[model samples]
Target: MAAVPLSLQVGERKFTTTKATLSKSGFFSALLAGPWEGDLLMDGSYFIDADPDIFDFVLKYLRHGILPLFYDKVKGHDYRLYLAVLEREHILGHFASPFHKISIIRKRIDEYGFILIWEARYFQVESLEKWIHDKTYLKAIKSTHRASEVDRIQDVSRSFSSELDVEYHTSWKTEKIYICPRRIFVHRGNPEACGRQCKQAQGTAEPEYEEELTVKALAIEKETTFNFEICMDDDR
Candidate 1:
């Protein structure tokens, strides 16, 4: 279909963009896949009924494939709003968290630098019972931190080779930011999943192990193309 010059009454103001522009989004592309006759107002521009404040970010992400990353702009409920729009659009997985939920990654300033403090995702590192049962969990966090130290080590004097770094590191003291993780968990899912059951995960080095992955993903933000994507409409 030809691109329609779409306009939406967001809050009280009007924002205009092309259907082709919005269609770069997996969400908006699907919404605009068919004729939008009645969605148009008297002015002949398609009207979107959505939270205008939130929709600005939505449209931005749609048009540019990036959610704003500024700490001030994207603080508090901004992420949840993004998740709300994405989930309602049935495109949450398009920008999924490692756990496939609305996990919070905070930029924490410390002596080490701005390390990513994964706010919502937490795993039990130990407890009175778990301490006696699982000392290996503590050891692993220390080991992983040590292992990720090279950040990347290359033997630059020999034959030229390129490789992707799979190693990751998080602070050994997660408690500095994450607070106290629950001692025992009967469920084995992410934070949102645990919240659904009114519980949190507890056991072993798994949560700490998983934290390694989260930190790695955040650490590679500058070095990798993991930030955003130009979403195309699915053939399905």
Candidate 2:
């Protein structure tokens, strides 16, 4: 007599396969070993209360050692379902770039990639868990460096625009530009020195300076090659 094939009913769907193929999984191996003989049906088909869709992947893997691939039709929830099935079936150490494929689906799911990593650990998928941990560490370092660069730029901008405005006064005679602080400007003949002494009155916040420098800067000869525009922010 021909041998009777092993039959299984997962959820609403029924399936038939050989004992040799189904026994590839330890869970199935135990089930076939008669420990759960009380649960076997009269027709000899084992009825499993599982999602047939997710269990289909495991059946294929048992038969041919094939793993799930990222296809256009595959959705983010499918990845989670696949992982859950693998865990339920006591499958381990058999991931073929699963996390990488899941990453492609992550864009549509939003934040699902991180959750998948945690699931990887929960399901004891060691290879995928390590890969996600390493990638997350590197991404965190990059984010910190990027934030630091933005802060540095803002600090430099603030310092340049802070109190005590810097003004440029050009002297045509020496063809040099004088960096005069505040309202002070260089005299016509001496391009290196301020036209007046900047005297700070004792116990006063303001610097008392003669108006002689402003008058001299305005009186500069018009034959100058380039004129430097002066701007001051009194509020600072």
Candidate 3:
């Protein structure tokens, strides 16, 4: 069969692309084939006859690397096919985590960068900070001076003030910065229990829970001290 143009609309956003080769294979067969399950017409219509929840889940997986639990054993083959497609698209990792597929999340970061990923999720700056902290991914670099030394330096700098020095030489100053250490978040609940519950909710009478994945950046710094001078002269 000839390939057709496919268009998809999620919320107010619209995406247009060529239909996959399997579009002519009928909906069930196409779904079993994977990836093609998300194909659409140029007019924002889909050929697959799936329920809204399943369709939405597939779309979410495509856009955000999130996979909802599949409940029905009869639908297992189809669901696995969908997952395979997601894996191929680099939207999910090879292994499943507590909340998501780690590989897919990593791929999204690799492809879009952290800022974009956060932006796409509509996350607040505080959420970003919390995410980093909760994930243990970023760490703040600490001052090298001892507590006493830092206190002494601050006191001395705060006390000394000279007009002549202000005009010709500026005093030295110091501050701290942070960096990411790179860590992964493990799920808190039992994997089997979560899965089973998730599946049951899907009307499949089975149990399955979607995995959750968390991230955190680690921080590192050195312990030491150094002296420096600053020149504020306007002319040589």
What candidate 2 gets wrong by more than 4 Å, as runs, is 1-4, 73-78, 86-110, 113-236
- Write down the lDDT that model 1 would get: 0.39
Q: lDDT ranking from best to worst?
A: 2, 1, 3
Report the C-alpha lDDT of model 3 over 1-236, residue by residue, as the tens digit.
76565554434545444444223223223333555434455655644322333344444433333223333322322324333333323321222321221221222334323321110111111222232324221122112322222222233334222211111122344423211111112322333323443444445333333333322222222242211111111111
Candidate 3 lDDT trough over 10 residues, lowest sum = 116-125
lDDT of 2 by residue, 1-236 (tens): 66568898777898998888766555565556665555568887777655577667567656664334322211312345444454543333454321211111112335445343212211232323332333322222111111112212223333332212323233323233333333444433333454334222123444233333221121111111111111111221
Better of 1 and 2 by lDDT: 2
Question: By TM-score, highest first, what's the ranking?
Answer: 2, 1, 3
Off by over 4 Å in 3: 21-91, 95-114, 118-236
Q: Give the C-alpha miss distance for residue 110 in model 1, angstroms.
A: 28
**Which portions of model 1 show Cα errors greater than 4 Å?**
1-4, 73-236
Positional deviation of 191 in candidate 1, in angstroms? 61
Q: What TM-score against the true fold does each predicted structure earn? A: 0.33, 0.36, 0.18
Best by TM-score: 2
